[model samples]
Target: MRILSLILALSFFLSACETVKGVGRDVESAGEAMDDAIND
Candidate 1:
């Protein structure tokens, strides 16, 4: 039972990390697009 709880906690943590990474990528792309528009 203890091992299962630990596994679940780790899985949730990993999922959150993935979501945060995705958001970071999206923000980076948005910044790049804005820069291109401003320069053009």
Candidate 2:
């Protein structure tokens, strides 16, 4: 039971990490696009 709980928690943490990373990438892309527009 303890092992199962630990595994579940780890899975959630990893999932959250991926979600945050995706959001970061999206924000970075938006910033890059804006910069390009401003420069042009």
Candidate 3:
């Protein structure tokens, strides 16, 4: 039971990290696009 709760907590932590990473990547891509447009 303790092990199961630990695993669940770890899973949530990892998932949250992934979600933040995905948002960061999207923001970076959008910034790049804007820079390209400005340069062009």
Candidate 4:
């Protein structure tokens, strides 16, 4: 039972990390697009 709980918690933490990374990439892309528009 403890092992299962540990596994669940680890999975949640990994998924949250991936979600944050994805959001960071999206924000970076948006910033680049805005920069391009301004430069053009």
Candidate 5:
């Protein structure tokens, strides 16, 4: 039972990390686009 709980927690943590990483990538892309528009 404890092992199952640990596995579930780990899975949630990993998924959360991936979600945050995706958001970070989106923000970076937006910033780059804005910078390019300004330079152009």
Candidate 6:
């Protein structure tokens, strides 16, 4: 039972990390696009 709880927690942590990474990428892309528009 303890092992199953640990596994579930680990899975959630890893998925949260991935979600944050994806958000970071999206923000970066938006920044780049804005910069391009400003430069143009």
RMSD of each: 0.5, 0.4, 0.7, 0.5, 0.4, 0.4
Q: Distance (Å) between predicted and true CA of 36, model 6?
A: 0.4
lDDT of each: 1.00, 1.00, 1.00, 1.00, 1.00, 1.00
How far does residue 29 in candidate 4 sit from its true spot (Å)?
0.2
Candidate 3 C-alpha lDDT tens digits along 1-40: 9999999999999999999999999999999999999999
Instruction: Report how far off residue 35 is in candidate 2 (Å).
Output: 0.3
Q: What lDDT does candidate 5 reach at residue 33?
A: 100
Q: What is the lDDT for 6 in model 3? A: 100
TM-score of 2: 0.95
Model 1 bad stretches (over 4 Å): none
Task: Give lDDT tens digits, candidate 4, residues 1-40.
Answer: 9999999999999999999999999999999999999999
lDDT of 6 by residue, 1-40 (tens): 9999999999999999999999999999999999999999
lDDT of 2 by residue, 1-40 (tens): 9999999999999999999999999999999999999999
Model 3 RMSD to the real structure? 0.7
Estimate the TM-score for candidate 5: 0.95
Q: Give Cα distance to truth, residue 27, candidate 6, Å.
A: 0.2
Q: Which regions of candidate 3 deviate over 4 angstroms?
A: none
1-40 in candidate 1: lDDT tens per residue? 9999999999999999999999999999999999999999
lDDT of 5: 1.00
lDDT of 2: 1.00
Q: Which pairs of residues collide in candidate 6? A: none
Pairwise TM-score winner, candidates 2 and 4 = 2
